[model samples]
Target: MPGEITRFVLKISLILAVFGASAPVLAEDMLVIAHRGASGERPEHTLAAYELAIDQGADYVEPDLVVTKDLVLVARHENELSDTTDVGSREEFADRRRSKTIDGRLVSGWFAEDFTLAELRTLRAKERLPGIRPANTRYDGLYQVPTFAEIVQLVRAKEAETGRTIGLYPELKHPTFLLQDAGIDSVDLLVTALREAGLDGADAAVFVQCFEVGPLRRLDRLVDVKLVQLVNTNDGPADEPAMRYGDMVSPSGLAEIADYADAVGVNMNLLFGPEGIPSGLASDAQEAGLAVHAWTLRKENAYLPPVLRRGTAENGTGDVLGMVTILEAQGIDGVFTDDPGLVVSALAQ
Candidate 1:
């Protein structure tokens, strides 16, 4: 840990040397959160991915949580498993496949809730987007779908090994659908797990996030740990249609959100308008006394803005440092990235 502390101190000094004394605060406060644990390099939501992210200097690792039939919390981008697991190839679990409507869209797949943790252990994690991240497909059958508790254990072990305090950013996926349609209370399960792990205290390095308002509002009443309201550019929270996401970034909307949320995790595009002018979202949300974190800074050309992209190949790397620089200038509190190593490098520059 002493080495890590020394590295951090050097990093701070380097920031000041390169960008001036005023730059230290922004460099230190802005967090580089691993979106699904350096997902650009490994199958997302697996222990290997999370560990890689931590080793690459990420301040936090994010896990999108879904439940099993036994109500155990596990990390997956969605409740459906076919895209990210070998469940579809397993003959024993073939009958488990079916169609269900989540958030008004009908999706057919092998769902996690249909199997117990033991049943899920037999399936191996795989790249969710093989067409875009074909390199990650090589490790397809190597890792297991990790549980929320298991992830906490991994973080603790890594902290002991690295001597650095790593944070957990867990997002309760489809909270409204999971509770109302699937008949599972993910919030209680998450809180109970955090409580058992001694991570529910106000000082704990945890931020509970949700895309729906009801769950975040409920969590605000249930836990002292920070809560984040995730907003995308296109739509509103599924539970609150009248509350448009576009409007949520407005001064009036941000004021309303500040009542229940400590931070707003928004789409990165929201921070900029047409012609790349500052959209004022970061400033507006901060003005409402709310921290603003931007989502998904990836190196792939497909994910980068046109000006920063290198070529037509969607899978090729782009100028991610330029993207990070733009967001940093907006005074964003944090950034979610698929490549923690790249973001860490960008911030160091």
Candidate 2:
């Protein structure tokens, strides 16, 4: 009970520090997306982490979607299970381990594609970054890998409970690999799932994001929901090997992307220059009629620039408030973060 009280006090203090009030409400214009839920605090892609993000006032919860052997969609950063699950320790499934080339890279592990949803349910979730987020390991082995359908149900329930219209940001992980290499039609699976959930329309509070260009273009025709084209700093989309991501963020590239995608979800580095000056990429994309959302704003020192890091410890929280402030000043529409409450706090200030 004393520990509980301490936690409650900390929570309220955090809220008050940013919002200057007891309630944790967010502004509607600038979006706070929970990258794999509050992954900084809990295991990524678990229902527990997602619920925590929603409770912390995240507008959207991101679930990187991968398919099971039964063709059901589940939330995982990648199809590989060993990193985020206890599949490696499960003696019963030891034989299931094998190597396969996914998206042109050879990966060896227990894959979601090899397991039916029932088989996956038998495994438990663990912190993917146990080295950096040691505290999150207390939650390790406590959650099951959640289905996208289950996530939708959780969101709908939360919306009703909170009276806030929460949004779903689902990324199709390795769509090209699922299609060409694994022989699964992920686009159809996703479209069918969203349609069944009544979230396939333009008015739906959802964004279908992908790193590949071809799938987003295909989705644009099939679904009315907004599409986000994810761009990396150095690498291009796997499906479009010859096309550089650098070109995609250019004026011409932004124009081309605006043709199909509603927004560009770019790596956070693209938004800032050497001394954290605003790069014109956000404004440039917006000028091309695209909303700009940035990927992966984390509080940890490991993920932050050396200037922003708070301590020598890699796991220590950094100047995320300052990072979000910079991105907000650049006028980006939304931010993806592992620590949603921190971002919410930053934006609320």
Candidate 3:
């Protein structure tokens, strides 16, 4: 029996060696992160959007979080609620519609911070880009603004039901604005929620992302889960100037980022040239031992580069699969897409 077992082990080892030497370098499995839940099909940040994303085989679901007056953390792309909700039409919030300088931009709107969780709950979500995504507008007024806790619960339930591990990617939107304007510690609230969900450990399938270095640095000290520093292609927001995102992709900038963040989520433009080919940014981040995840892959021709656009309409279809294929070839660790199914299918190819 011992002699027979030894012969079998040798045979398997020989086969592996033969195949391994001839095989091309295998690529890491590219992750498909549903940007704001399958946001292309539903009102972004709503539970319906998230659920659709999960159904489409997303590995992670992203929620851009903002704070409410009662200090509840809720899913919102920005604190300004006018564009993404039905606040403007509601006479009850008419008096609440006032402009204030937030993060250096003077804006007038019914802000989320002015409403308690219950008040915010009474409102319904709308399509943020109705003109560009008329189909998604069909889902408007169908879902409520989900709280961070509720989002966590939904993801947990999905995981248990589907028997598949899905990650949570929550961005702390405008941390400085929240801290200065409302005296709210957004990171603390996020960390508390993550801990309560039993997802604050180092190995937990959670990524806390922020655009500012200061907030990311603070979060690194508070949470054991992975932290991602988001970089905009343009110079930092006008009201809040910091290091340019271009600089952040530089060797030294990435090195500094590696000190606090396990990964970098950059504007997709940084990974491509005007001719639509791979650039050095992904390789540089990998060299610095930081995982790279690119953002905002939409099907609209307007959102895509000139080289990849398929039509002239603002809402016209583009070669999303072609762009995704190029990005995958660049060896990115993950991608953020409004259409999670497209990315999943492209990656499978």
Candidate 4:
């Protein structure tokens, strides 16, 4: 979404020069944003998970926002109803299973937009990454996806109860495509919800992120809260047939985005590039005046780096140290990990 002009000199900064010694000290103060609440400890997007995240010391608890059929705001990864729920097992709604191109993929499943908020709450949350969270399944059917309003209510109440400011980070998932297909996009609704809850303002502790730039731009035109443009070079918008996300990460691409958004949430791989670990994007990202936040950090070996794998001295039995390593080395403003406890522990150490 850069304008017609683009420029890049690759003037990477030298923050990493003293990083070796600074790693321990920096880890103590790094901002930790819970990926989907304390997902490492509870079902994601459920109020329980988010509440635990705050109790565990998350600077912000994230919720991916979506709208239901009744126009109420709910939380879910994709509007998809299959992977995260028992929607497929319900014979009554079995006919609801179908396919549609969401953000350009022929995805077929029961989608969130197809249900009302009331209906959604009747369903329970499942481990989206069961391979990494088999233990989490013990609590399966224990929690339900919560509404943005519910989260706002909880966070405000927590701020009062704990005397600590806890922020909310929301990603306006697939906004443009939602409008193009489902006739339901939640940015306006989300902004309105924030205002109604007294959480929308320059001083509001909120950060909104999205992979697509169009919605962020549109949201900027609507409200004055912080916004982030998420990037994924591997399978992002650019890779989509009719998508242009690939163009969004380039120097010119990012500069254009910096115009409308407050920061960028690039995939961890992009921060480390194809090389992985020991490397960070502090210099390049800093040049853009954009704060970098990486996502989906977890303790599972699948999500952990080889050197920082489970049970290693460098990373312990969890994913925090390895990730915090990258966070410090790269001078990242924050990160989204399932284990806010681990993140908080790492920060304290």
For this target, which candidate reaches the highest TM-score against the unseen true structure? 1
Model 4, position 165, has a per-residue lDDT of 92
Instruction: Give lDDT tens digits, candidate 1, residues 1-349.
Output: 3344345345544654665434423434689999999999999999999999999999999999999999999999999999999999999998999999988789999998889999999999999989889999999999999999899999999999999999999999887888887799998999899999999888999998888999989888888999999999887888997888998889999999999999999998887655555666887898899998999898999998777777799999988777776677667899999999999998887
TM-score for each of the candidates: 0.92, 0.91, 0.90, 0.87
TM-score of predicted model 1? 0.92
Candidate 4 runs further than 4 Å off: 1-28, 235-246, 274-280, 311-319
Candidate 1, residue 265: CA error in Å?
Answer: 0.4
Between candidates 1 and 4, the lDDT winner: 1
Answer with 3 or 4, whichever has the higher lDDT: 3
For each candidate, what is the lDDT? 0.88, 0.88, 0.85, 0.74
Q: What lDDT tens digits, residue by residue, belong to model 4 across residues 188-275?
A: 8888888887777879889999877667877888888899988775666522455455566667766787899888887777766443
Model 3: number of backbone collisions: 0
For model 2 the local lDDT of residue 159 reads: 97
| Candidate 2, pairs of clashing residues | none
Q: How accurate is candidate 2 locally (lDDT)?
A: 0.88
* Candidate 3, residue 259: how far the Cα is off, in Å: 0.2
Off by over 4 Å in 2: 1-28
Q: After superposition, how far is residue 118 of candidate 4 from its true place, in Å?
A: 2.0
| TM-score of candidate 3 relative to the true fold | 0.90
